[model samples]
Target chain A: MTAVLCRHFGLHHMDIAEDIASDTFLKASEHWALNGVPDNPTAWLYTVARNKAKDYFKRTAIFETKVRNEIIPESIENEGEFDYNGRIIADSQLAMIFAVCNPANPSESQICLALQILCGFSVEEIADAFLTKIETIRKRLQRGRKNLRNNSFQITTLNETDIRSRLPIVLRTLYLLFNEGYFSKTSSKQVRIELCSEAMRLTLLLTENTLTNTPQVNALLALMCFQSSRLDARTDIRGEAILFDEQDKSRWDQSLIQRGNYYLVNATDRQEVSKYHLEAGIAYWHTAPADDSKWTHILQLYNQLIVVEYSPITALNRVFAFAKVHGKDKAIVEAEKLGLEQNSYYHALLGYLYAQTAAAKSIAHYEQAIQLTKSPTEKRTWQKEITLLRQDKR
Target chain B: MKEFALIFRLTDISDFQPSPEQMQERMNWLGSIAARNQLVDKGNTLLPVPGSAKTVKPDNVVTDGPYTEIKEFISGYIVIKAATIEEAVVIAKENPIFKIGGSIEVREVLKRD
Candidate 1:
């Protein structure tokens, strides 16, 4: 609602737009408590917010002149009616996302602003998502807003060129949002679901619009759907993290898997393949029943993924796949070549591979893994591995 | 149900100037309480020290106040309908002020007549 109001009253009046939005919620809270919530809560909120904005303009002479001259169109003002529906709200949100993703701001600031403004993430939630301090998140948000204001960036409909360049950042932000949800340090299931679902929701918005219905968008959506399908199996009944190999396949959501397949098919319609396409393929393989064929396919996809977009985590994951395809020794050699000694996952994989050969070496690697990670779950898993290795040695 | 005032006390944060996003979260928090029919008054934010504050002495001499000697001041207060002080405290615990290291005091209101 705030985004739409800002769109209506020029982005420069973001503060006013925010004030009006806050007032709308305040009014809703007071009124709803007295008289039960209205039948159409959203429409009710929209009407109240619009009226509040109108009142704001009427009372503030300066805003009235500014609205007339620079903000709302004269035709819409002459009509004395602001007709709004769900589509307008969605467009406003999309425009807000683009404005937040302005190339002027750093990528981190762009992601932080998008999560805070578009997804309604709290500062603390964003900080948790990014694995950063609350103060750092606050500073990023402040810098992002100041950059937006100084640039006088408006939320406008983008052309193809603009969309092509800006859409990647938007996709990257959503990807990170989803990853944060999937692998958050917090033990709360609700927070993880909220983050992942919010990311999927925003990505769905892009797919719905004609301008943004690109192959890469579909691929990312497919990737999220595939990953989300396994969310139920990602943890044990006690809420402890479950390794992918140990997860129960029956717990996975088949419907979501089907939906993922649908998007994956659509994603392949274009000749160009993005990193999302490769990741989605890898995710798809994970959904399949455990077999040598699936592991071989996954390893191939990882090979392509590394060539296209390399990250330390991805490289570590590839090593695990390499172990399945070849032997533990070969996988260990490849993992060591990456030189990610500081990464807990790297050490954990090495420990697993070494357990198949030398138990003493495996214990050392497991100890390193336990020492490198701050996550209690990871530490516990590595500790268990170390105990198992020692028992075997004895 | 009885009415209680949830007074927000804290060091001045006016200089911090919370971002719109932060303010929106606060409004959402207050809105949730109001939706539950507990909020009696939305309350107002107090001006910072050195702004429109005066302490009148017993002799009717007004002195510029909100003394800087004190580290904390009551920044705002919201009246809420609760069955007991405990209930009010539960509600106050959810206040956004705590996120910024502020504190809340839940005191019952004395009914007149």
Candidate 2:
């Protein structure tokens, strides 16, 4: 809806487009309750929205007579525009994705805007995804919109010259968006799936576009698909976090794995490899049965990923992969040097490594992990492990 | 086989905004039942998005509000063919709605031959 309205209201009126879309939904809810949903709901929504836009333009003093005549539709009925215009809407939405991921704004705000405007995510969802407060998300979004409005930002959707250059920021925003949804501890499984799906949808959009169909986009899509296939198995029936080893392999979505393979194959169309490509490679290896070969492949990918973008978490994960590739003792040496005492996962990994060697050290590490962990679900799982580990203390 | 109506009731859906994935999950749940040849009738849902629950009585009397006063509203229903109410309940137990605080009442449907 924002995309469709962007076409009529122009790029500067993106917020106005959003308001009109919301108003259209409000009108639908009220009228549909009184008169029942129409035979073709999307068609009905399109017609009503177009009519509302026409009325809005007629009443607003934003434009001169000449501009109003040019911008506003003649009549909602005369155009026979009852159905959804998918092609144009996709193009408009692709433009919005690029526009919303403005490099001028803080990366976090860009993601907040993408979630709120592009994905129809409520502030609460965004907050839950980021483990932040609702007020903080609202303020961040307000700040982003303020920057756009105060600057009279012109997105210039047609400019293909810099589209290739601007792809990184957009991809980064999408990667962050996907990670928040896929890896969030507090959000329900449904929210996780929704946000991950939204990120994948946008990435797929870029892949389908003639100009933006880069290998990087395909790699990102592949990574999302691979991760999404394991989403259901990531949590147990009680909603407790399940580590990858404990997850029921049968529960994984096979079709999605196949789809990920297809996209990964497509990503190999070019020579340049990205962080997404390496991540996707690791994720693909995870979908297969756990073996020495699988661990070796995953370790290699992690090594590449760390080199491409070195973060503390990446280093920690690479160590885990190293444990799988080499041995636990060597991996423990590498992990101890990282100095990630604040990270719960880091502690948990340390506990796992020390379990077979020094039982007391393992128990101590697990206890520390239980202390540092914020999620009650994770705390419960680790506490149970500590109880079992204590039995073998002697 | 006997028929049963599995009425889906949701608790306080005022803020429920069904995402693309949630909608697809709902469809998959229904599809699973249909695949098992248990689906008798796929009923319409009073979705929170298009929420409209009206009560009509005799003599042109009607009320335009959903049953939010009771803190629960009939979101949807589906007819399923099962040998017993217990069997019908097994099918109802599979609904994704329960993940989000919804209930399914599996009542045997009366049939006149």
Candidate 3:
């Protein structure tokens, strides 16, 4: 609703749009506390926001005349101008995505802006998601908004070519958002779930649009659905992250798994393959009933993913699949070649692989892993593994 | 309920010009408290350092103010009604100044008999 209002008033009046939105919420809280929530809370908020905007315009005649002459058409002025429908709201949000992801701004700024403005993520929440300090997130948002204003960016539908060129950044932003939600180090599960749902919702918006409904988008959606299906099983009763093999399969959401499969099928319809396609394939294998054959298929998907988009994290994850497919000794040799010794996960994986044959080396790796990681939970897990290795040695 | 003044102390490291998002978040926090009728004063941000400031000394003598020797300075203050000092501390903790490493000193406002 705020995005729509900003679009209507022109992006230059973002401060005004934000003021009206905040006032609407303030009014809602004051009124709802006295008289229970209205039957149609959305409509109520929208009406209050519209009235606030109207009041602002009435108070500033020069600004009102400028808006009338420059932005709003004379003919449309009489047609319930403030009555924004669902379609307009969606388009406004879509335009907001493009506006945030403008090539002129840095990628980090774009993601931060989208998360805060479009997804309603607080500065602290965004900081947690990106593993950065709150001050950094604040600067990113400031620079992003300043760039938008300087560029005279406004919310409007983009041409097909522009959409095609800009779509990758949007997908990348959503991908990072989902990853943050899925593997958040923060204690709050609710925030993580909200992030995941927001990412999925925005991705769904892309899939719904004609210009953005590409193979990569479908594949990304499929990957998110598959990963989300296992969210319940990913954490233990005490909210600690559980290893994939130790998770209880019964807790997985079967309906979401089915939905993931549906999107995966759609993703494969095109001849062109993307990193998302490979990732979705890997995620699908994880949802499938675990067997020796499934591990082989997962390994193949990881290989394809690495070839398509090589990242240090992806390479590290690929080593786990390699360990599953090949013997531990062979996998250790391959992992050693990756030169990721500084990474805690790399040391952790090495410790696990070497625990059976090389007790002293495994203990050393576990200690290294504990030293490298800042996460208390991860350190505790490594300590427990080291204790077990000592017991085995005794 | 007692009124408490939340005095924000700005460290030298603090960002003088906070981003718009930071400003909005601070406003929203204060707005929520105000909606509940707990706010006594919305408060004001102080002028930047090395600016026009004066200190009135003994015998009506005036000098350039804000002791340059001090590393920390009083930036702003907001008064809110709370049932106890603990409640006031909780309110003070919500101020956005802490995000940039500034500190808030909560003091109870004494009432006249």
Candidate 4:
């Protein structure tokens, strides 16, 4: 059923494909539990899917009459590959992805909608995944769907020309989705391993597709591979976060590192200097042979990343890389410019940098970092730094 | 072998009346729980007390039948088979039908020796 959905819908509509498949199975389970098991399971599954799609359309119509215009008629007459009834919607997943990624809607909304509709996740689950409220997710999805309808966004297959244009947004959405699943933003007990795996699977699909084999895609894939290699070491026996430097590097999946390196090399084949290229390069540099002085190489990549995507977090990372490549004076200049006390990570890094300088204010910066950080792990790490700095001052 | 009955008493507060749906949900949850533990023999809700007048020896007095200052009136309860007060108290923790500002008072039923 999932394969059929993939074949019909496309790779992007993962949420929808999973939803329909799950719904079909749930119906099957409920029916078989109540009555005896059906003789023909596949036909029964299709019937259930058809009914679900119909019900969905009816519900959509009932909720908003405006959407009635966009509703695909259930009539089997002249039904082709796009028909949801007996004709079977070929590449439906891709169609759904393109619809969600439609330029009419905001990028966040597109990603949220894809997560909700294609990925079969409830708004609450997505909300938990992103550390946002359920209401916020609902609103975003509502706005996104409305935009999709308003724009009348319908495209079957993306061309090479447009794939490059759309691929970054697609990659970013998947990357963030994987991140949320890997490290759930909420205090939920279980890590959403399925979401993370699904995101990687989708990225692999893009990588395999003829039109989408761009350098950016390769870079993103590389980044995901490198990050995924450390998934096991991210959480300890108690499921608490482990610091990056403190992680057991021996436990890191060597196979994933090799794969990441492979993609990283592929990403460099193109001339364009995308943020993914720089970010993946940085990841490769970290996971490379530790003894090699790759700091200069990494510092250059960070500089490029900063130029492309100068977000606060990126800037913070850049400062650390600069500190490694250059000396404390150059690093401190960049750190001070960021107003370290405001951002916890920035403050923590500044505290470390100041401690290295053996300055009197290092303790103050560490204290500021400890106060600013909310994460228990982060706070503990910073507090330790503060203690060391204070002892050094003595 | 010893047989003991735990008589659990409860009161319904009028201001804390739950909606019909909420009441149904609470009742369903409680019913399932009681059935699972075989604690409930019977339970019910009584309508509000009516005003009544009674003639005394010398003077006539007119007041509500309940004769209580507290808002809550004796609502309903279930009979439980328990060996001791400690056991009955443990059962009380699992009761799902406790509404706002309501309390359960459990007492040992005296068996004639």
Candidate 5:
């Protein structure tokens, strides 16, 4: 079913392909429920899909004015019924990925459309995944599709020459897919298994493709593998989020760590460093921790990241890394400038800084943090930090 | 590109004091979502009643009166990118305000140009 859909998508319009697929399923679903299961469900689905495709083209002759003449003859419609041996040149999913995430549209729209068309996510599901309104995701998807059509987007043929230029966007899309899987801001549940698996599948595909087998691609795959290995440990048995320091190291997959190390070496082969390279370095540091003192190198990487990204969020992250290297004083000095004191993490960081200094102002920061944070897990963590600070002073 | 104004009105503020942790959680949820989606060009949450001055004209005389209505106050809004009214409606359905109690009025934002 997947292969047939891919083939049809490449030869015909994707909108037509999608509509045909949807009609086929609607018929199959209704038919199967009444007539019991068919002997060959895949074949049945193909016949339906092909017939729907023909009907769609016939019906939409007005809007399909651009390529009205390109439709295959009625006799050829049955030819795609069972061409299992025929060459499947380009992957439809690949075309869809490039078409949706085309650089012509905004980044958010790219991600939203990719999630919807490629991953088959509903607007509500995507909204939950990114912790945004359903309207935002819907608009992004709609706009992205319109833009792609208007721009006459040409999907980058995943060949050796164009791979280097387009690889970064693909990798970023994969990263977003994985992050949505690993830590969904909207789902009350812990993780999105489907999204995670889809991301992993795409990454594996990228690694397998001769054109996309770059050191950075390998590094991204490795990072995903290593990070995913600990997904089981990220949430407690109660299904609440577990802080990184509290996670059971024994639960971390050794094989994935080894794979991560392999990619880390590959990523460093190029003298130029990207954010993924720094991220992989951080992941590696976490993997092989003799003590918390070894985090200085990781801090240096975050410093480099801030210079490149110049995000207040990145700067906030670097402050914690600084605490691991220097004392709380240096870290607090950095954190103070981030203006995150109005947020929850700021209070948690403040509480820790106060614990180190036993200063009266530290309590105020902790209180502010407690006031700002929303999650129960985060609140508890900050509360614990505040309690410890008070205990030390007493 | 078409324009749409998402008029988000905060409804039913329960006698709830969101602890700092809750505030952080909300901020993280909102900030990350906004960053990922880029839904708004710029937005600011209005204070409950940021000292308002109202002039009441009664019998050809002007008088100062605090004019407030619970149902029709504009809390906040975001101007967004949309192609059509249906698209705007689809986007509005996903708003946090529209979940259980609150509502968002999605209208085409008029362009000056």
Candidate 6:
């Protein structure tokens, strides 16, 4: 709705777009509680958003200086008409995304702006997801918004050339968005699911358009679908993180896995093997039957993934697969070389790898993991691992 | 079966913004009542906004304005048919508003028949 509203008025005030979106929710909460939810809640929200957008424009903008001033009649209320058409909203969203993914902003700002602008997440929500301070997120959003406003990014239908150049950056933002959700440290399962779904929804918007539907986009979408399939099984009844091995396979959403396979196949017809393609293949293997070959395939994908886009998380994960394929000792040798000492997952992985041969080292690593993680559930889980390892020690 | 109206009250709604999941949760609770065929009438919200009530006395004066000063106000109501007050209270107990610290008052509706 903010995107649509920005489009409605020639895209002058981005901050007003955000404020209106927030106010629309406030109105809906007040109105719906008093009047009950309307038959078409989505339509209701859109209408409220439209009104609030106009209200915000009137209240906040300096009418004499804004783009609206040129066309404004005596009563500016009816000057700009909001188009609620699905295609137009998609176009506006694309514009908003491209504006956020502007090469000038740092990669972190790009992801943060995408979360705030494209995904309709509050700054606080983005902060919660990143496990960073709200003030830091606020400043990042301010900087991103400032960059966008200074650039005067217009909300127009993207041309083919613009789509061609910007689509990769947009896809990367969504990819990181999905990963942020998939690998969240937050204990709230609902928050994780919401973030992942929002990413998928925006990516689906891209896939719906012919100009933007590229192989890498499809691959990223496929990867998200595959990971989201396991969202439910990734947590236990108590909201603690469940190890991949212990999670129930039946709980994985088969439908999402099927959708992922479809997209992955769609991705293969294209020549370029982006990191998303590799990651999608890896995620697909996770849904496959766990056998020795599965580990081998996953290990191979991780090897390619590291080469494609080497990050600490990918290296850590690659080490896990290496452990599965070769012996634990060899994997441990590789893992220790990464030197991700501050990472809880690294410590936890080390704990898992050492459990069999070196119980004392395993317990020590679990204790380190417990200390490194901020999540209470993760701390408790590592504590439990230490207890189990102690029993094995005797 | 006796008809009962469950009135929902909230302390503050000025800043209440229900997320998609919370909206879905509330809808699920409403769906459950309808599924049991106990839902009689989805009642209207008595207070349009917080403190939107108007009172008129015998004289021509009227007293009503923003209830911003008040701590609580009726948000809405829903009517359900149940065999007894206990059953009505059980239905009221299931309202999702309570999850956010709101309360529900379930009362039997009197009909002159």
Give the alpha carbon lDDT tens digit for every residue of B20-106 in model 5: 544433333233223223244535554444244354566886543233444434566666665587966765665545443667787
Looking at model 6, residue A203 earns an lDDT score of 93
Number of backbone-clashing residue pairs for each candidate, in the order shown: 0, 0, 0, 15, 18, 1
Error in Å for residue A291 of model 1: 3.0
- State, as a TM-score between 0 and 1, how close model 6 is to the true structure: 0.69
Which segments of candidate 4 are over 4 A away from where they belong? Answer: A1-23, A32-44, A51-90, A155-164, A181-184, A187-195, A339-341, A356-360, A370-377, A387-394, B1-113
Per-residue lDDT tens digits for candidate 6, residues A1-394, read 7777776664456676667778888888999999999998878888888777666556545664485665443334534555677777788887778777888788889999888777778888889898899999999988877877777766666788988888888888888788888878887777788889989998988888888888888998899999999999999877788899999999999999999999998888556999889989999999999776898778767765664554777778887887787789988876875657998889999999999999999888998898888888889989998888887764
Worst 10 residues of 1 chain A by lDDT: A72-81
Positional deviation of residue A303's Cα in model 6 after best superposition, in angstroms: 1.3
Candidate 1 per-residue lDDT, tens place, A237-324, comes to 6567888878888989999999999999989965788999999999999988877588877876776566555577877887788778
Model-by-model lDDT, in order?
Answer: 0.80, 0.79, 0.80, 0.65, 0.64, 0.79
Supply candidate 5's per-residue lDDT for A103. Answer: 82
Native-vs-model 5 lDDT?
Answer: 0.64
Docking class of 1: incorrect
User: Number of the top candidate by DockQ?
Assistant: 5
* DockQ scores of all models, one per candidate: 0.01, 0.01, 0.01, 0.00, 0.01, 0.01
lDDT of 2 by residue, A1-394 (tens): 8766765565566777778889989999999999999998988887877777766766663464565555444432333443357776887788888878877799999999999888998889889888889999999998898886676655445578778777999999999999988877774778878889999999999998989988889999999999999999989777777888888999999999999999999999567999989999989999988665888677667655664565767777877877886699988876775667898888888988998888888888888998998888788988887887888774
Candidate 6 wrong stretches, greater than 4 Å = A21-82, B1-113
Estimate, for each residue in A279-303, the C-alpha lDDT of model 3 and write its tens digit: 9999999988877688777766666
* TM-scores of the candidates in the order shown: 0.73, 0.72, 0.72, 0.63, 0.65, 0.69
Give per-residue lDDT, candidate 6, residue A27.
87
The residue-by-residue lDDT of candidate 5 on A160-193, one tens digit each, is 5555676788788888888778766543543366
iRMSD per prediction, in order: 22.6, 20.9, 23.6, 28.4, 11.3, 23.3
Docking quality tier of model 3: incorrect
